[model samples]
Target: MTAPRKARSALDLATVVLSLMVGALGIWTILAGPTELLPIHYNAAGQADDWGSRELLGGGLAGLALLTLLLGGGMALAAGRTDDPARRRALRYAQLVVVLSIPLISLLIASASLSGATDISGALPVALMSLVILLIGAFLGRVGPNPFVGVRTPWAYKSRLSWERSNRLAGRLFFVIGLAGLLTAPFAPQPLGLYAIVGAIVLAAVWSGVESWRVWRTDPDRQPF
Candidate 1:
């Protein structure tokens, strides 16, 4: 088989394996975890403010795994049907991100829940999410115009130039934010790091949206909606 085909197959296999592992972890947690109430929500200080049964946490993980599987399958199907090689690659990249992220999130949550820690650290989750943002940024510019991924602003949909420039700008911003967050997470105060990441993401999104509009307004080839 060709290199791309091989790579696609590998990704598909990885997605299935990872999903299964996450599902298994959820099952294990359900079977072996504490039967009493567990921390289900945390404050900015990373202190558990809300409580729930272990079954809730385990079931959530299982649901996440199922969702990941469905999303991966959908993306793979879309990639297979796409005529453009670039768009197909973009879909695959998106699929890779989904495959990697859901499992990481699940593992982190599971670890915290199973540990029975009332006060967990936010640094790790922030760092992991930062890594995910960085990965997305690395690929956003190359995603091409697709209904399923990237910054899908109306202006971006109308203008290819808008899509390219806005996504590239967003990508750069997210990459920088992710890098900064990853580096500062350990040192930043509780909840502050989380706030910073959320704020940065919002800023990036708003900026990208404005950029798309601006570029679309000036694009001679922009399509009328």
Candidate 2:
């Protein structure tokens, strides 16, 4: 009995642990992200430079970190009572990644400077991070623990077929987008690479949403959910 109670306590305390981690990332980000004569100073590149020089880093990064924490925690807290096994697993995975990605990303960028990788830029990191997110989304779509990520929409949620179809489409779209962004950066215009990544994500979102709507419309006479 004590063991079960302890386990339940541990599960319930996940949010606290997650929040602390996010907080720490926020602090690191606020520390102005490693200042050195690297190729493209993350602090100077692509409007991240707008953060400007302050001896004490501002709260902007920390605020973003806090926002992610709140959003992730809110999802789990809001749905704690869900009886859906897939949904629970999905939430766990998403929250876990969300908690980890921000700081890891910052560390990667900082290390690039240390390693003399002057060409290291946000483009590569952004593409890589997006790919990671898409991969996680694929897993969630394949074995959903919830309805937050992947090809989420009313119709997709109603029918497993729609859910699978739309998400598979989304998965492919994201992969193509990620690949194009990664491979084209060395040759293509920087903005073009950004456009490709953003466009792919938008296209996937629109396509999945539309498919879900169309599927729902097909069963107008019958309530699918």
Candidate 3:
């Protein structure tokens, strides 16, 4: 059964409000801080090479808040309108991603603000990213058929079994990659460690996509695409 429109709207509003609250906190923190400049851009090596006016932080926070609202609201609306189990589950997963990103956005802004004074190593941001990846990996397998989440492809969408198995394998790969990133952050050079983590992500995504295609081809129930 589909969720009630009123209930779903309320949930979406709450989620957006929560995200705005976090954005407000982030902006407030940036404003109250002594730093005039915040690191807004990073190098491929994970180093914060480009700095910008603190106002940039405020702008970024606002953008993120708006994006969260749009994505979360859209998913909530979809969930409420659809009685299909797969679609609902997928929308829920997309909603979860939006909800989870709010805190990470706040943390990233705070980290950059703090780095202005302490020159904190790139490891901090890398660690935070790894944590996000770990959390996503933890639940990715449970995400149902959706265009917005998981390894979406013609083959995978044609075969439920292919999607499920590919996501399961992806979850394991992502988890291991995130764990490896966390473990490497403290001991390795900043850029190299970040590179390793990036490599892991690329590898996981490629492997899962390829696997999905392979599995779909072998599935007896899969229709010609």
Which candidate, 1 or 3, would have the higher TM-score against the true structure? 1
The whole-model C-alpha lDDT of candidate 2 against the native structure comes to: 0.54
lDDT by residue (113-141, candidate 3, tens digit) is 55573333467667777877887787777
Clashing residue pairs found in predicted model 1: none
TM-score leader: 1
TM-scores of all predicted structures: 0.86, 0.58, 0.77
Per-structure clash totals for the candidates: 0, 6, 0
Model 1 C-alpha lDDT per residue in residues 26-130, reported as the tens digit of each score? 887789878989887776556789888878888988998898898888889899999988779878987886786777777777777777777655677778778
- The local distance difference test score of each candidate is 0.83, 0.54, 0.73
In model 1, the runs with Cα more than 4 Å from the true position are 120-123
Q: Model 1 residue 9 lDDT?
A: 96
Per-residue lDDT over 1-225 for candidate 2, one digit per residue giving the tens place of the 0 to 100 score: 697456435644664564555456446644654554333254322223322322223243355456566756765564466677666555665555444444445445434533445443356665565555455444444434244456667777777667666766766676666566656655666555555566667777898789767766675443555
Candidate 2 pairs with clashing backbones: 86-144, 86-145, 87-145, 87-146, 88-145, 90-145
Residue pairs with backbone overlap in model 3 = none
